[model samples]
Structure formats: structure tokens, C-alpha cells
Target: MKFGYRIIFIVSVVIFFLNCAYYYPFFSDDSLISLRYTQRFIEGKGLNWNDGHPVEGYSNLFWILCTAILGKSGLDLIWAARILGLACSVGTIAVILNCFRKLHVKKEYVFFATLLFVTTPCISVWAIGGLEQPLYGFLLTLVLTEVLYIITSKSFRRIYLLSVWLGLLALTRPDGFLFTIITAGFLLFTYRQTKTNLLTITLAVVCIPTLFLLSQLAFRYTYYGELVPNTALVKVKITFHHILHGAFYTLSSFLGTFVLSFLGLYSLFILVIRKKDLFGFYLLLNIAAWISYITLVGGDIFPAYRHYYVVLIFFIFSIILGLKLNLPNWVHNKLQAGIAILIVINVFLQYNIPQNHRAVEERWEFKGMNLGSTLKNTFPDKTLIAVTAAGCIPYASELPTVDMMGLNDYYIPRHPPANFGTGILAHELGDADYVMTRNPDIVIFDVGNTPSFYIGEQLKKNKTFTKNFIKVTASDRDADYILFFNTYGNSTGIKRTDSELTIPGYLFRNNEDNAVLFTKKKLLKKMSINNRYEIILNDIPSKNWKIKNVLGKNLEVDTEIYQKNGQLTIIMIPKKELLLESLVLEGKD
Candidate 1:
């Protein structure tokens, strides 16, 4: 419980060990998108994804910019990013300890909660996953610390500093703006309590954030030519389904992993039931802002639950703050034991979960390494390359690329597919026609993938696409060797599974069946005018298969030994023989 360097070192060591525990360490693929931007900046490419266009493809700008600056020194970027993530996460623990001491919480209680936080594997998850979560966590916890100071002691300087932190938080993640606004509003409204004037208090609270926001807007308009980051548009559907996913994302990521999440939620409810104070009310406002923001964005796509990381960190600190002021002695004794048991169970789960496998779920980040190399070797000319997921491939390859779903594109995100709703992820589907019109030499559908991105689906069917690009994997003759991760076999040859057939642009697969799927209703209109659309078959049908409409209505099908110029015809050969390979739709467009 003592605030000593030894305790700090112990907590720090525990953090590092637990972070490296679940499995052999691996960074996230999404993190690489920002790294790609950093590398571009390092290369003097003027911070653009493409040569001339400066699009804000990434959400974590300050992190990318920070690393980009470090990248200029030819630093070991992998180590740098990971190390920074660790530092920020560790810093959150230290700040928590300090805040508890400042609020006069029992030293033992502070140490206990802080220990639980340090050992929580989810804390370590982001520590090594290589993203802005740790930094965001640190900034937010620090805000809570200042929020405590502002509410308890009425420090003038802390109020302004809180504004600066709030601004920096927003700049770090796009959704952070919600926190900034809510905090600023709380401070202004509570001016009477602070014993400061509205004018003085407003300046104290809003000055730093206002300037930071203005500077951000000016730079965005001048460089990226957009007021909002491109990712803001890319990851948005904002439907009721999104709210449902948001709830699932938080529960599954936080409560599913960190046992303390239940404690944190319960603590909030208890606080609401008990007497309300300035600090408690402020915490509630911030929590509401953040939760709504997360719901609006449709939750995180990355594993290990990133979106709520900082919120949980802040929430835990606030819980400690409230408990210090109010819990009974008997309740305190029980919580102590409860936390100890939770810590053990939490560690056990961290060690046993599917996350430890490092293959099926955690393999994406490791794949980025070889995938990037393969992309580079495949596209030796450094021409235009399009990818659904842009981070890992573009970052590792260090090549000129297009973010097809529009995170980095100027056009595609603005014009998404007709009916784009994945309901889980929140990115816009790229315009298939536009990507084709741009004519990327090698288009990839890995990054930011979704059903709507089936503009990617339609792209493969487009005559121009099939004519220009070929389905080339990283292990293809067109690419270099790809060493799979530990569990995967040593050989680079990966056989295509049945699931591979469903992938949009896979090679040596059924082009027609997987290409442009037309249901019975659309099929009628899809037929060319005044002629039967006769698709060449590779073989005959073995079973009865009829075209179905989008609404699942079966259509009346009629066929014959249809033949075009010189193609072989087998419609009349026999029944119970071959698999269906083609279709003959007789109708007018």
C-alpha cells in the first residue's frame, strides 16, 4: 500500500509478464494501417496514402503521427510501438495509485485494485496488440484524476489541463470528441460549485480544447480536404442493429474477459442509488457519453475488446474513488476477498481462452508480416494496389495502395453499395464500379471485409476486372514464400478449403457460382435484351438447382441444349451426371 518505487516496479513487472502470457506476443493488423501512414511520413511522402491524395485512413492520428516522428530516425518501429503501448498502459496503473492516494482512499484498497488492473490480461492485450488503446487509457485515467481534483479541491490549473487532455483524447480517437464535449459541459455547468465565474471557468475549461479542435480542423481541411477523418465515414451504419452489437461488444469483451467489468457496472448502479456528488455526476455524464458513442459506432471489430478499454480503466478508478468515500467496513472486507478470487479466475481464463491458441483468432496480426512482404514482391512495379483491409498489407509492403472501403479513398466511401448492412462492423462498402474505374492492377478484398463490400463481389464479374487482374495469393508463383505462424505447418502451400470458395476473388474456383449471384427476380431483369443469356458450362448438372429470388421465392426454370458460336453443349447429354456449372436465363433486360 505504500507509494514506493518497489511497488511501482512490482506492478510494472506484473503488467509486462501478464501481457506476454496468453500466447506468444502478436500485434494487431488494424494497428498497421496507422503504421503505414507513419512509414509514408517517414519516407517523405507527405502523409498521404496515395502519392498526391492525403486521406485520413486511420482513426488513431496522434499515435500514428508520434510513431511517424520516431520512424524518421530509422528506429525499430515494431519495438517502438509495442514499447509505447506498454508504457501507456503501465502509466495508467501509476496514475490510478496516485489518484487513490489523492482522494484519501485506504492504501490497501488502492493497492488491491491497482494489482487487479495490472494483472488483468486484457490490460496486456492492448499493451502488445500495438494500438492507441493504452495511450487513450492513460489520457482518460489522467482526466479522471483531474476530474477528481476539479471536483474535490477546485484547482484552476487542473481544469485547463483537463481540457488539454480532453482535446488530445479526441485527437487520438475520433469518438473521443464526445468525452471532451461532455466534460467541458459538466465543468461549465458546475461553475457555481467551483466558486469560479462562468467566464473565467469557461476559458479555463474550453481554451485548450477549442484551440486543439480548430487546429485539427484547419489541418484536416488543408491536407486531407475533409473536415472529418475518412474513417468516420467508413465505419458507420448507426442503426438499431448497431446498438445491439454495441451491447454485445461491451459485455463480451469486458465482462467476458475482465471479471472486474461486473464489479465496475455494479459500482455504477450503487453510486446512482446512493447520494450523488459532483464527481459522481461528472463520472456518470462521461460514462453516458462514451457508451452512447460506442453504440453509435457499432462496436469494435478487433478482438481483445479495444473500444471500451479506456472507459473501463476510467471506470475502475472512479469506482475506487467512490468506494473510498462510502463502502461499509464489512463490504470492504468481502470486496477484498472477492477481488483476490477474481484475480485468480481472471488469470486462469486469460491463460485458457482461445486467445492462447494464437492461430485461428490471433493469427491475423502475424499474417500481416508475410502478407506485406508477399504484396510487395507480387507488385514489384509499385503500381496501384487495392485492398479491403489496408493496414497490414500496405504497412508491411510499403506500397502505393487504395483502401477500397473508403477509409483512405476520396470517392468509394461516399458512394457505398445499394444495400450495405453487415450489422456487426460499421464500415461503408466501397463502390465496385468506382474501384474498377480506377483500375487497380491487383485488387485485394481482405481489409475491412463485409457483405456489402460485395461491390468486391461485382468487381470480379466485371469484364474489365477479370481481363486485368488475376487471383494471386501471397504463396502463388507470382509471390514470395510465406512462413505461417507457429501452429501452421512449415510449408507455404495452403490448400483451399470449401470456405475458400466463398471468398470473393479466389483463384482456380467457380467464377460463375461465386461471382455475381442473381436471385430469380433479379435474374429476369439481368438477362440481356431480346436474347437468352447463355452461360458456357464446364459440366452438366448432377442435381436439380433452381434460381431463387432475394426473398427466397423459387422461380420457374426452363433450359435446352443452348449453344453460342463454337462452345460445347451438354444440356441434353444426360441427367444424374455432372455438377451445375453454368446458367441459361431466357429473358430481356
Candidate 2:
């Protein structure tokens, strides 16, 4: 009877996961970036965004490689990945349940908690999103299961297995190091009870992961010349604003995904401090650590909270752990049943609440797939492209793109943004100057399926931009209406400009009569502090010119230079009917 019940419970959870996956079947824009990497690898171009250029665009190195393996075998990319990820997602429930069974959690309670976990929108979406999160979550649960075995029983073989599992966890995601560190705490806390010795402990906790990490680091550093992935510098701005956003993200995730959004954190407290349950403590500690890390980096901006998928799973596990420790276990069982019932009700009652509505309205999910198909069919390989979105455009088009928002580009993430005050995320900021320098053949602005970027608007203000890049009026197969600009020299073999164009800073105001320059060269301003600038004004300016004087509201040849952080806005107001001529910008000896 017990065996039959276990099989039915597992089957039911699997069924629930499949239904949710099919109901909200959409691939994330971010996942396409990895798919592109996998494609490049299989095509013998290596694991890079382009054939020659090797940039570690993705942080999920192991998964990228795994997908490449599947692609290499001549299987359909999306279906194969979905099949594999679904298996891993289903495996997560079984592993977690087995741990609970071993920990002596009640069978009914285990079934209920596991059901709620598998059905949660956050878990269901990523489980079938064709990303590595499902596999990452699976590896994480396996590590947790092995740790549980170590705490409950003592064996050298189990110790070795725990080390291997933890190492695999780290390989799945770099942040898995936190889990290994916290598990060391669990090991030492119960060292005497479990009879784990010093040598074994040292090797398992520190040595195994260290060896794996070192090999990866050595290769990555030698290849990319950077220790961390290129994406890290672009993201993870640990500022006050980012921390606040992280805190807000945590609350919103809990509230949005479950019937009672705040209960997960509260239950974690009850399980750890009140019940004194060691397993609960482990889960809570890991959750706290992961949340702190995510908060420091700023919670992920993607819908469905994809970044916190692993943490959410652990969080649900922690909540279940607390439920296992409740007074008069039947009352706790009733509460669990109620929570699960609420989730089922919301899935149907509020079908569009979690993320389905926005995803449908914005076509957020299909943007990448659509753009990818268009690019692969329309553009040839080696076409130099630039786009606000780094993922879909490069992946779909197979174009060696200058990632304007800097996910794959090396220079964009390392430099300060050209203009600000409007972008959605700091890490997604684009360098207009750098993009202009790269001179891509096709520059897609807010158009296409990805979110539109204001950086394109910022670039439009540049004079060289208007001269060299012309806007295309036609729309692509995708309904993205954002502007698309083609570089001047795309068709013409000859360079349009007579002389090389180099400006000290951004050209904010560039017109026929008067031009204004916002110079970021603060050092020049500081040096010119005592020295007066030779302000030459045109003798005649157009009637549209508001100012007839170039200096201090009066027409003068000399003007004093004042430095504000070495930046100066040079506004040239010419004399009536006269245009600024023979522009000379040279430093004195």
C-alpha cells in the first residue's frame, strides 16, 4: 500500500509540472544566448559569440557545454533541451521527497509539500524553459540529499559522494560555493556525532570544489583574460539602490508565486529558531546566504524570477521543513493542504496574474524566437550587427554583433555609460561611442522582440551618427516598431567623411548653425582653469540662433574656463547669420 501511494504521488507531481509547463510554454530571451553559444560550439566556431572573438558571455559554462553536446548529436535543439530539463525538474521532486522520507517526515506531509513545490509558477516555468536551471536545481537537491545522509548516518563512501555532489553544484552555478561553505558548517556542527574525521572533512568541504574551480579558472582566465564571466561586470552593481531592489524583489516573488507570499520567510524562522530542527537550519541558512547574495547583486530583472529559481526551491524546502516540525502534526498537515489548495485555485482562477498576462501582452516570450528565425533566414553569416538586446539578435541572426548593451562585448561593460536617467537596468546600459566606433552594418534599435533601449535615442544626437547612419523605414517580420539604422559605408566602398572624426565627448547639440559639445574631458577643464579659452564666434548666425554671444552673454573673443569634474559643455552661439567655422581644438605647448 505504501509503495503504491509513493508511485502515485510522484506521478501526480510529474503530471502537474507537465501541465504547467505546457500551459505557459515560453522560452526566455536570456536562454537563447546560451543556445547560440551551444550552436557556435557545435559548428566548430568554439564557445564564443563570434568565430574569432572569444568572450565568456554566459556564466553558466557547464550547461552551455551540455547543450552543445546534445546539439552535436543532431537532435532538435529546443525539444532535446526541454526533454532533458523536464527530466531534471521531475527528478528534483523525487530527490527532495527521498530526503524527507529518510528524515522521517510524514508521508502525507511530504506528498503535500512536494506537490506545492512542483506546481509553483517559478519552478514550473524554468523547469521547461530549456535553460540549465532545472538541471542546476536537480544537482542542488542531490547535494542536499547527500548532506542529509551524512548528518543522519556516518560512512566514508557517503562523504566522498557528498564532495562530488557539492563540486557538481558549483559547476552548475558559480554561486554554489556558498552552499559548500554552509554545508561545512553543518558538517562541523555534527562532526562528533557523525564521526567524520579531519582529513576527510578537509578534502570533501574544500579540496574537491577547489580543484574543479581552479581548472576552470585557469582555462577561462587564459582564454578571456578575466577571472569572472564578462556578464558579471555588466551586472551586479552592489549599490544602495540595488540592495533595496533586491529586498523588494524577494517580497514580491513570495507574494506573487504563492497564496501566502510572506509565509515562507516566517516559516523558516519557526523551523530554525523555534523548533531547533537541524535540517531546517541547514535550509534556512542556505536561503539566507543566497538571498543576501542576490540582494547584493540586485534581484534578477526577468519575469518568473528566473535568477532565484534555486533559492526558491530551497526556500520551499525550508518552509516544508518547518511544517514537519509544527505542534500536533495533523494541524500542520491541514495548513499544508490549504496552501496547496490555494495554489491550485489561483492557477485557474487567476490564470494571468503571475506572468502569463504580461508575457502575452508584450509578446515578451516570443520576441527572441521570432527575431532569431528572421535573422537566420534573412542575414548571412559574418554580418556585423548591433542591437540593444544581446541575446536574441546575435543568436538568431548568427551575426557577429557588437552587443550594444554589453553582455558579449568586452568594452561596453568596463566603461561608463554614454547617457543615463532612462535605462531599465544599469548593466544593460550601452556605450554609444563604442558602438559608433565598431561601425556595424545593421544597427537595430528598440525594434525586434526584446525590450526597447533608450540608448538608441541617445546615439541619435551624435552628428557623425546622422551623417553615417540612415534610418530604415521598413519593418521586419517581427512587429517590433523600434527604429533601425544602417551605417553609411554599408553599401558605399568609400568612407563618406573626408577627415577622421574624433570628439572629446558626446555631441548633444549638432545642427547646421551652432554645435554644442558635452565634454567628459575633465582633465582639460582643470588645466584650463587659470587660462582663458579663445572663444571664437561666427560673425553671422541663422535667425533661429537664440544666443548671439559666445561669452558671458556678450560677444567676446576670450572667455574664462571653469571646470566641473573636468567636464565642460561648450555651447557655441554664433553672431547673426554666421555659422561656426574652422573649428580648432588643440592643446597648447
Candidate 3:
């Protein structure tokens, strides 16, 4: 039996590794946010989001530190992050298996539970997401297992290990402090029964984690000049409106798949009632606190139940326990078969539930990367660009960017709109006037597309912005990139000029004098037929001008010239794609 169980465990681990390998290539956009910071730090820029501007935009401190250390060894930062995440994923699995073994869970039960955990998409997919969640999950599991061990064995010998893990967990994410508090409260509540040294236990449970928290706070204050991350200021809000949205986020993530959601909640309810099992009771409290905290903060923006990953193992363990306790003897005999069926159903749902959503994120990330590279090649290095999707575009472009949504900005988060929480979470903060003051050479709304957020709308209404910035289209074979370009900025490629062909009593202000000066320089994108150019020449007696298509005979173009009342009007009908050197009108006097 022992040999068979050993084989099962080894096989389960292999399957879990394969699951991670399958999802390893799909990179999350938000994960790039951390990598960008890592890249800057490795370049000796410190924790500054942009150059010389320190803002605690990222929530993962230790994850960035670990990745930066790997990066210092000349590893690619993206791969560094992914490799660290893979290590953490394996560590989490090993810790859980060890915990189960120490608890003396039945070999058959452990095998089934391990199968359920390894098959869940949330675990496998998120493990390779290049974010801190995998590390967070690993530390959380170690801490939870230690708590369970202490509760079951009635021994405080390894309590110090719990303290160290708790401290590390808190460093992984800001909300990790919640678990520290919960563990401390539980220890204090059960102090007298254990007859342990109260002061010693307090030092291990409370002091160690508090010291970790304090040190981070000191670093944050010293480096960024703030105690809390700017992200918390922008995103975290405690209100009835946010709680409702968070509840919806939570419900949608769970109810999006009925069987899995039902199993988790039902198992948790059963586990809560088993008061004799102190581990189950403690888990219930932790989950409740977590739910409330996530609810208050308006939930997460990323799909695949990002915020719920830390407690995923607890839910899986409870489901296994619930199945064992609630089912009849006949069903218990086929527990392994039942769990194997559940795993199959879950794999099917995983494709639709999170995998589809992940595909959408990947598409946007790729688009941002393409757009950023184009902008980098087209624009001057000093040319500043503003954007709403603050991750891939800015990182790929390596440009100084103004985060329109204020995730990495210093000004906007401090001055949000009055009715902030009523709109989309974290997207409610924007100051059009403030952004205009920066005078960005190129302003990209919704990540190089159209305007979709508050700042974009605000900028559209500003008269100064409308007068100064001209909306232009730069098209290539792949797609059309739209952005607002400053009309009067230095380093000129396109400029508005009066028609050299003159006629009396006629002004050539075609489309508010928005004319392109074909300078023969390679623009960001090829000029498509969508571009229009009209010029009216004044004081011209007759239509003596002949239109010339400089582009070779392969591409067709239609040009019209009309003369009325000694005024010559020329219109370049964009019938085909043209380069900057396509049109040249010569006079035949």
C-alpha cells in the first residue's frame, strides 16, 4: 500500500508540473508591471516607477527583490520572474504534501486531494503568471500548515517557523498582514489552555511579524516618501458601493462555474461546524476575514480569481474533508473515482472560465507591445507619451510615460474625482488639467486606441487640448494606430503650411489647416488612403497646375484640381495607400 501511494504521489506531482508547463507561456499584463520595476531596479534606477520619481506602485516587494537578485546574475528579468514563480509552485505542492503526511491523513485521501489541487486551473495557471501570487501561495500554505500542526499535535516546538513564514508572507503582499493578525489572535485566544510561555509565544506570533511589517514601512517611507503604496490609495476604497461590486466580482468568479463554487462553499460550511477540528475552525475565520477585506477593497481587476488564490488550498482541503464526512460508506469506497471525475469536469471548465479571459489579456498585451515599439521607433527619445494601460506600452517603449489612470503617477491619485467609487474601481482617478500641464508630445488613450476612460473624455473637452493636439492615424499592414499628436511640438516631421500655389480671395485651411509636410522620413506607420489633404490656392488665373503621383505606377491615386474666380482648389482623393513621397504638384507655366 505504501509503495502504491508513493507512486501515486510522484505521478500527481508530475501531472501538476505538466499543467504548469502548459500555461507557462501566457504572460499576464499586470505581471509586466512588476517586471518593469524589476528592470528599472536592475538598471540601478532604484524603486522609481519612472526616472527619479519614486512611487510605491507595486504591491509585491519581496517578489521584486528576489527577481532582481536573479536579474543581477544577467538572467532575463521576464524569465527570472517566471522561473521564481515555477519554483514557488513546486514548493507549495511539496509543503502541502508534507503537511498532509504529518497530519497522518490517509494515503488514499491524500492522493485524491493532491489530484484535485494539481488539476485546478487557478493554481496551475496562476503559478506561472510571473506575479507574486505563487510565492504568496507558497508562504501562505507553509504558515497554514504550521498552524494546523500546532493545533493538532498540541506542540509549540515549531511555532517559531510559523512566525518566520508569516513575516515572509506579509512581505509578499500588503494584505498578508491580515493573516499575521489572525494568527496572533488565535494564539492569544488559546494561550491559557496550552500553558506555553505567554511572552515567548507573543514574541514569535506578534513581534516577529510586526518587526517585518515595520521594516517594510520604514523602507517605503525612506524610499518612496509614503508609508502605504500609491496603489492602495488609488484602488482600495471602503464603501457600500465597492462592497457590492466586490461581492459581484466574487460571486461572478465562483458562480461562473457552478459545480466548483457549490463544492467549495458547501465544504466550507461543513468544515465550519466541525468545532472539534481546530484547523477547520481557524480556516473558516481566515476565509471570512479575507472575503470581507476583498469585499471592502472592490475586488481585483485581473481575471482567474487572482485574490482568491491564497485561500484556494484551504478550500480544496475542506472539500476533501467534507466529502469524507458527509458521504455514505458506499460513496466513500469510491471517493477516488468521484474526485477523478471532478478533476475532469474542472479541466473542461478551466478552458472556458479563466483560459478564455487569459487569452483576451494576452492579445491586449501583444497589441500594446507592438504599439509601444512603433512609437519608440517613430518619436524622439525626449518625446513623452501618456497612456491608460500603464504596463506593456510604457515598458516596451522604454519611454517616459504619464499613467493616465494614475497607477504610477504621483499627482492624480492624491486628487481623485468627487464620486470616485461610483465608477470603475481604480479607474476613477484622473485630472485632465494636470495631464495637460505636462504637455505630452503624444497622448494615447486606452493603450493606443480610442478614449475609454475619464481622463480621455476630460481632455477632449479642453479647448487648449483640442486646439493644440490633432488626432492622427498611423496605419501599417497589421493595424491602424490612432493617437493625439501635439501640433506645435519641436522635432518636426508633419506640419501645417499654406499652399505654395497661390490664388487670390481663396484660403487653403483644409480641415483646420491640418496638412502633412511629406519630409521623406519614415513615419511610425504607412499613410493609408484614410488620410485626406485639400489645398485652395488664391489669385490663380487658370488651372495650369498638373498633379503628379511620385509613387510608382503600381499604386493608383486620384487628384482633382478646379479653378473658379481666379482661385485654384486642389484635392488629393486618397484612393490608395501612399508614402510621404507620393504626391508632388509642379506648375506648368
Candidate 4:
């Protein structure tokens, strides 16, 4: 038994480490949101998205503190986040491994359960994804373990200790308060079993979490003038549209991992039949409540079922107990070998699954990192920028930012649309007029240099936005950048000449109302492989204008024009370079 335990523990650690390594360089952009807060907090800027402006954009308070401490020690906050997350994940494994032993689960079952826990791609992906999930997982698992010990031993001595862990759990994530409430309810539900010290037990279980909740609430109201984080306001809308989307999101996650989902659900069903079991009952409430809460919030936008990881931890113990309770005599005897085979299959499937959110995020991070570096180099430190990706670009640039999505904005959430929950989760709140009033020097619609969010779409139609900002492309040897520049704002002596029209990558002329765009044929061909470019000419004269495609017959070119909201938009598909002289727009009176 000792040898088997050691082997499984060592092997699981190695496998988890390797799994995290496989996901290297794939940091969650959202994680950087917390780290940015950490950076500000460490620099004495007061947990703010913009300096002197206090808004609790991050939900992970404990997470921010952990990284902030390390950042204060002069460590890179990004690395600090990654290391802390991974360590907490390893701690969770250690807790669960010790838990399996305490429950006296068989050696084979231990191997199966530990392997399943460690091999699940979601677990390891989040461990290094640089968010608070792993820390939340560790705290949650520790709390559950303590509860299991007390329930099995029928002891209330360590229940007070459990309260402190529960408090920490609540601080790790806003939704963690749900767990504390459930645990408090569990204690109350089992009151008859502990009739000796009712008042003491009640105080221990209830007062600690209540205090923590009150303290947090008081701090929020005092500092940011809100009872909850700004993120909650942006994300936690209770509309039918959001609920329906959340339902689909939760269903797809379960269906994606059908085998594991089946086992977890089956385990819960078995627990339901055993009406007298206290621990199993507790597990059922936690799982059901969490699933319901996740559904209510419109699920998560990130890939890899992150919101479900805590439930995954609970599923482990429940499934192990179910196997012991319900398997037939023969099946129980052969369960070890059968599960070993399943573990092998699972290892291959989880690591090699075609789920490629990591790849997509990696590309986005690369683009954001470069754009941020360019912005940092190009503009003054005080230049205010507005961005939809309130993560990588802002963190890297370290400039004042208008969080276009309201995740960190003070005004947008308070002034949300009447039908706020009808759009994308966390992206439904924005005021184009409010953002433009800030006079942001640069406005990035998305990380990938394209208009991709509700805010960007709204700004595109704003006449003030169209008249004051121009689409500018700047290129460094390291990266090509595209963003909207506010021409009405301070240019710092950077002049736009109609004769040269130089902006690193391309050249264009904005002379009077006759505009001409020029790009090297090679560059255009490289950028537009589909042989197309969409150009919107804003603030055009209200005259019948014709855009002539004069690139010559050496190659075919097509031009289509649409006039809307005083803007003439053209879709040009050219087989070669767009010559400045060839792109003449002549207006007929």
C-alpha cells in the first residue's frame, strides 16, 4: 500500500507538472487583469485601473494580495501569478491525496481518482493560466477535506479552523461566499448531532464568514463606493437572454466531457439514495448550488470550463465513494484494472484534445504585447487610451486606460443600457459617448487590431468619433500596429503631411475632401490574401462621389461603395498595390 501510494503521488505530480509545462506561454489575458491591479496596489496606486480612480475591477482580492506581495519583492507579477497558481494547484493535489488515505479508499481507487484529478486538462491549464482558480481550488479542497474529517469523526473541535479557511475561500473569489453559506447551512442542518455546544458552534461557523463578508463589503463601499466589485456589475446581469446563454454554456461543457460528467452525476445520484449520509448530502448541495450560480451568471467566456473546476474537485471524492458503495462484487474486484486502463485512455485524450483556446489566446497575447510595447514607445506615459481588451495591452503599456467594457470603468456600469444583458457576457456595458468624452488618444477595438466588440461598433457610428479619430497604422520592426488616433487631441508636434503621409507601414493622403490611400502592392497583397480591404471614409461631403478603381488592367480590381450615416465606406479588392493616384475619389455636384 505504501509503495502504491508513493508511486501514484509521485507520478501524478510529474504528470501535472508536465501538463502545466505544455500550457506554458499561454497566460489567460483575464489573469493579467488581476495582476494589473496588483501592480497598482504594489506601487501605492490603490487597487485601481487608472491612478487615483478607485474601482474594484478584480473579483480576486486574496489573489491580488498574493501577487502584490511577490511583486513588492521585485519579482515580475506575471511570473509571481503563474508560480502562485501552480503551487496552490500542487497543494490541492497533496490535500486530496491525503484525503483519499483518510477515507481509506483502496489503492487502485486512489490511483484512478488521483490520476483523473491531475490529468484533467482543465486543472493543469488553469494552474498556469495565471488566474485565481488554482488558489480557489486549493482552498475549496482544503475546506472540503476538513469538513469530511469533522463529519466522519463527529468532532466540532476543528470546525473553528474550518471557518478561517472558509473566510479565505470567500476572499479568493466573490462566488466563494456561496460555499461558506452552504457550509454554515450544513452545520445548522446537522445541529441535533452536535447539541452539546450549539452557541459556540453557531458562532464559529457563522460569525467568521459574516465578519469577512461585512469587512469586505465595508471596504468596497468605503474605497470604491460599491458593495460588489465592478466586474460583478458588468457580468452578473439576471436576464432571460443571459440565463439561456449560461444554460447552453454549462450544457456544452458537460457534454464535452461526457464520461467524467456521467460519473460525477451518477455519483451524486447514488449519494441521493443514501438519505442518512451527512457528507454526501453536503457534497450534493455544494455541487447543485454552484452549478445553479454559474448558470445564473451567464456562464463563463473563457474556454476550458474554468467555472466548473471547483465542482470537478467535489466530483472526485463523490465518485470514489460511489464506486465503493455501488459497484458489484465482481466489478469492485476488477475496478482497479479497469480504471487503470481508463486512466491511460484519459491521459492521451485530455492532453491531445483539439480544444485550441490556448493557441488562439497565445496569438492574441503576442499581438497585445507588441501593440503595448509600441504604444509605450510612441506615446507619453500620461496618454490616455481606451481598450476593449482590459488585460494584456493595458498591463503592458501601463498607461491610463478607459476600460471600454466597464470591467474597470467607474461610469459605464452605473450608466448601462436598459437592455444590458442582451449581448455578450461582461461585454454588454459601455457608453461610447462617455468613453469619447475622456479624450483617449488611442482606442483599440480589440487585441487583434479589429473592431470586434459592442463598444467599438457603437463608436463606429458616432459622428463625433468618426470626425475626430482616424484609422492609423504604425509598424515597428518587431510588430505591426493598428489603432484609431484622436486627431483632435494633443499630437505632441507629430504632424500629418499630405505630401508624405508617412506612418511606418503605409502612406495615405487626406487633402480637403478628396482622400487617397496608398500601400505598397507587396504589403497590400501580404495583408489582404483574400484580395480585399474595407475602407471607411468618414465625414465625406454630402455629394455624389465616385471611387474609381484605377489600379490598371495588369490585374483585376473591384470597388463597391456604400453611404451610411454621412460616411462613405468602400470595399476594394485589388490584385496588386493600391497606388495613391489610382484611388482618386471625385465628387459630382
Compare the candidates by lDDT and give the number of the best one. 4
**CA lDDT of 353 in candidate 4?**
53
Quote the lDDT for 510 in model 2: 31
lDDT of each: 0.60, 0.61, 0.72, 0.74
As for lDDT, the candidate ahead, 1 or 4, is 4
Q: Tell me the lDDT of candidate 2.
A: 0.61
Candidate 3 worst ten-residue window by lDDT:
500-509
TM-score of candidate 1 versus the correct structure, residues matched by position:
0.76
Q: Which parts of model 3 have CA positions greater than 4 angstroms off?
A: 1-6, 21-24, 193-195, 257-261, 320-332, 354-361, 490-521, 524-578, 581-589
Off by over 4 Å in 1: 1-9, 21-24, 193-195, 330-336, 349-360, 377-379, 422-428, 447-453, 472-589
Cα lDDT of model 3 by residue, 455-519, tens digit = 87898888767766766555544666666766444432222233323211011123532323212
Assess the local accuracy of residue 493 in candidate 2 as a C-alpha lDDT between 0 and 100. Answer: 13
Between candidates 2 and 3, the lDDT winner: 3
The better candidate by TM-score, 3 or 4, is 3
- Candidate 2, TM-score vs. the true structure? 0.77
Q: Candidate 2 lDDT, tens digit per residue, 1-589?
A: 1433477466657666665545456666677778888898889877788766588888777777777777889986666667777778778877777777777876655665565566566676776676788888888888877776765576556777778777777776777777888887667765645454756777887788777777788988898887988777777666777788888887666666654334466677787778776777788778778878887777777667676677667766766666667747547536655755766764663355655344324444366556555655544465577776666666666767787777887887777554322235444467677787877766675334222465566577766566555342223432533323342435211112222212221111232211211122110111111222222122221122122222122232332322243332234333322212122232221
Backbone Cα, N, C clashes tallied per candidate: 5, 9, 7, 1
Model 4, runs deviating above 4 Å: 274-276, 327-333, 348-362, 491-589
Residue 526's lDDT within candidate 1 is 18
